[model samples]
Target: MSTNNIGPKRLVVGAHYGLKEWIIQRITAVVMVVFTIVLLVAYLISGGASYEAWAGLFSNQLMKLLTFLTFLSLFYHAWIGIRDIWMDYIKPVGIRLTLQTLTVLWLVACAAYAAEILWKV
Candidate 1:
């Protein structure tokens, strides 16, 4: 086959991008671990078993900050994973571009919404 007609090598290129995704996944995983541990410890210390107690805890500034970070990291991690899947499986260039665009927009929207809610809290 002529080199000109050789379609982009799928799995090889996919793996190239996968390395970056792998790093992002690991970083996000670490963030999640720390966030989970801290959140659990905070909850345990608060002993806020009731709904109102939990609400109060969430209303606190520090807790709100932590919550925002937790959600943001989660959204980012999910976005990266889904994007990788799309890049690997979606072979059509136009469709892949559109999906990637939508993914980024969604992530930004989610992050903005989280920030707004956290700010209000």
Candidate 2:
């Protein structure tokens, strides 16, 4: 039998999100954790859980900026995780793309709303 029937060999490479997403997930998680710790420490030191106390914690511009950054990290982390799920499970390209777009829009809207609220406070 002749061995020339097969076409040229092709190499298939996936989108390779392992390391990048892993690192990002960890970094975002750490950011959230650190924020939580900071918030906790402030709350503990203040010894008051009233609305006034909460208001005081966020009165500082630096704390507001840090809060915004933590939220940004949170949204991005969620996006990466959701994108991976769509890439892995959703078979149809069109549906996956549509869902991904919707997800992004939703996240962006939420982020914008968050920013507005953060500033308003």
Task: Kindly provide the TM-score of model 1 when superposed on the true structure, using C-alpha atoms.
Answer: 0.74
- Number of clashing residue pairs, candidate 2: 0
Q: For residues 1-121, write the lDDT of model 1, one tens digit per residue.
A: 5345355753344447468767877888888899789878877987867777677778888878877877887888998888878988999999999999999999999999989977775
Tens-place lDDT per residue, model 2, 60-104, is: 899999999999999999999999999999999999999999999
**Alpha carbon lDDT at 85, candidate 2:** 96
Q: Rate the local accuracy (lDDT) of all candidates.
A: 0.81, 0.92
Report each candidate's C-alpha RMSD, comma-separated, in the order given: 5.2, 4.0
Q: Best lDDT goes to which candidate?
A: 2
Which predicted model would earn the best TM-score? 2
